[model samples]
Target: DLAVLKSKFRGALVGSLLGDCLGAPFEGELVSSGDKIVIQKYFDKLESPDLKGPIRSYTDDTAMMKSVAKTFIDKPEVDYTYMAKLFVKEYFAEPKRGYGESIVEVFSKLRKRKFEDVYKPAQEQFNGSGSFGNGGGMRVAPVALYFYNNYDAMIDVAKKSTQLTHTHSLGVHGAVFQCIAVSQALACNPKKKIDPEQFCNELKQKMKEVEKENDDGLNLKVEQPYVDKINVIQHFLKAKYNDELDEEIGIVLGNNICAIESVPTALYCFLRSLEEIPTVKTDNIFRRTIQYAITLGGDTDTIACMAGGIAGAYLGEEAINRNMAKQCESYEKTIEMADSLYNAVCGASNRA
Candidate 1:
């Protein structure tokens, strides 16, 4: 079990890296039916053992994810301020990682204000509504892995860490939803097939609890958006996979940057990829998950990254292709971070 957990940790972090790296090149492109063929071939080329090219570069998704993992490994106690600093530091060190304009502004403010109030800048964004973007959900894999055994702590840290930039209930709860998905995937045995219906049902139940607690007396148009998305994901999954179905999913579940749009879409990607996709020619489910996500288009990197994390957590490292993973930037360092996180958790548990 320890070995399995360790492999899952590696799978999750590395899977996230692979998705961001591979998906970055295609971000924001509308995936027409013709485009799916190009995406399929692209994946085939990346998997070829003899293929040689520059390693695929990751976007801000993996950049922020790395900082989150580092924070957990370096600090036993959760440190929101330190985590905020790491985000700012990583962004400044490499400003060209495709971060969104809003988050960049938050980083700039955090530095200007000396991080005296780490959560203030984000709270001030978008005329106090705050961002409901998928930024928080994209980087939440570390929180899921670190607090793998503690459900309450995982949800708590997921919300707090996300609040460092995303304070909107939708933004915060979406991150929590993503965190729960990854945690559930990590708990699954790689040797067994996952029942997609059961998986969504479990997620829906947990998200309902999360949404109930999030009732802040603000009567928003959609009271339980994520819960509604989970219902949509369940509905979509029941239908046979087809081009038409894919279009419906894009329209209904969405493939955009908003957390409400992308997070559940990522979960749908993971669940749908469990079976063979007619368009994608992969025997490997992990490949199928991300490749399917990319074909859905908008916010490609982050959606693929989030979906990949869930798939990889379910499948563990062995399910991921070694040759394909080597094509991503920071693959080695990502593995090291995963191992360090595993040790940090296991070491603390053993000591206790």
Candidate 2:
């Protein structure tokens, strides 16, 4: 049983890294089926033993993901400020990782020791409205995996961890939703078939409770408001993906960096890719998950990274493309960190 969970634990992290690394090159391009083929061809090229030149590099997605993983590894209970320090540490170690604009200010403010408040800058962003970007969601898988046994802890800890860099309820809710998705996925019996219908409904119910508690002025009457977005994902999951489906999903579900738009969309991509989609030819569900997410085009790296984390939790490393994974910077290191995180969780479980 531990072995299965371990594989899934590793899968969740590795999937996040692979998606980030592979999806980084085409981050902002508006891609089509033709563009999807180009991405598929790039993967085909990875099968070669002697590949030449710059492999696609991971951006802030993988960097902060590692921070989150390291946070879980270093502190079993997940200290918010300590986790924030990891984010600050990673940015200063290598500033050229193509971090998003708003996050850079968060990093700089954290670096100065004069101010003891680590979360002040983030709360002050957008003229005190704060950033609602998916930065919090992108790096939250580790939190889910670490707290898989305790849903209440997972929700509270996810919020605290997210608030380290993103204080807005939009940013915080995305992390909460993503963490629960990953947590639920990890708890699933690897041997049992997943019911997409039941899975999405459970998430929506839980998120409904969360959103109702923390009303961020997002009117409940709005169609597909936060919790309702998960319902939309359930809609796409039951249908086969087509050209029209692609366009509609991009419009309604979205594929951008905002936590509001991208988080639920990533969940949709993972769930929909689990079944056969005749339009995309790839049979590797993991690859299909990332491919389909990227095809949507906006915020490719972060969306793929998020989708990959979900799919990986269900599919494990066996579904991943190793050659493609190896192309990413710090590939082995991330994998090792994943394994280490697994050990930490298992050790905690044993103690409990």
Candidate 3:
């Protein structure tokens, strides 16, 4: 079981890295029906054993995720200040990772304030409504993997760490939703086929509780937004895959940077890829998950990153093509980080 878990840890991190690197090229372009064909060929080429283009570079999604995992590995205690410092340090060290303007502001403010109030900069964003961007959800895979066995701790840390940059209820809950999805995927047996209906139902129930606890009674425009998104995901999953259907999903589920839009979209991508996609032409579900996420178009890197993390958590590292994984920049370092996070958690549990 430990061996299987270790492989999963690697799978989740590598999957996240591959998605960011591979999906970065098409982050904002809207994919038409014809574009899917080009996308399919693109994946086919990427998977070729002999193909040697420049390694696909990762974006901010991975840049931030590495900091999150490092915080867990290097600190025996959960330290928000330390994690905040890592995020600022990483951002400043390499400012061209495609970080959004809003987060750049948050990082600068954090550094200026000397991390005295880690959450203040984020809370001050968008006229004090905070960021609803998927920045939180995009980088949350490490929390899911680190607290895979501890559901309450997973939820707690997911919310707190996300609050460091995203305090909006939608942003915070979306990260929670993504974290729960990855952990659920991690718990499934890799040898068994995933039941999409069952997976949606379980996610729906858990999200009900998560949403209920966070109800502020002021934002009544949408009740239980993430839960409603899960229901929509279920509906879309049961429908046959088609270009028209994808259009509807894009309109309804969305593919933007907003956590409410993109996080559920990522979860849907992972679940839908569980079956054969007529266009993708991949028997490998791991590839299907990220590729399908990319095909959805907007915010490609983060959506793919989140979906890839969930898919990898389920399938383990062996299911990912080594060639494809090697194509991502820092792929080796991602594996090492996953291993360190695993050893940190499991090693502590063993000592306990």
Give a tens-digit lDDT track for model 3, residues 92-199.
999999997798999999999999999999999999999999999989999998888888888999999999999999999999999999999999999999999999
lDDT of 3: 0.92
lDDT of 2 at 227: 82
Better of 2 and 3 by lDDT: 3
Candidate 3 regions exceeding 4 Å error are 217-222, 349-352
TM-scores for candidates 1 onward, in order: 0.97, 0.93, 0.97
RMSD (Å) of each candidate, 1 decimal: 1.7, 2.4, 1.7
Model 1, stretches more than 4 Å misplaced? 217-222, 349-352
Put the candidates in TM-score order, highest first. 1, 3, 2
What TM-score number comes out for model 3?
Answer: 0.97
lDDT of 2: 0.83
Worst 10 residues of 3 by lDDT: 343-352
Please give the RMSD of candidate 2 to the true structure: 2.4
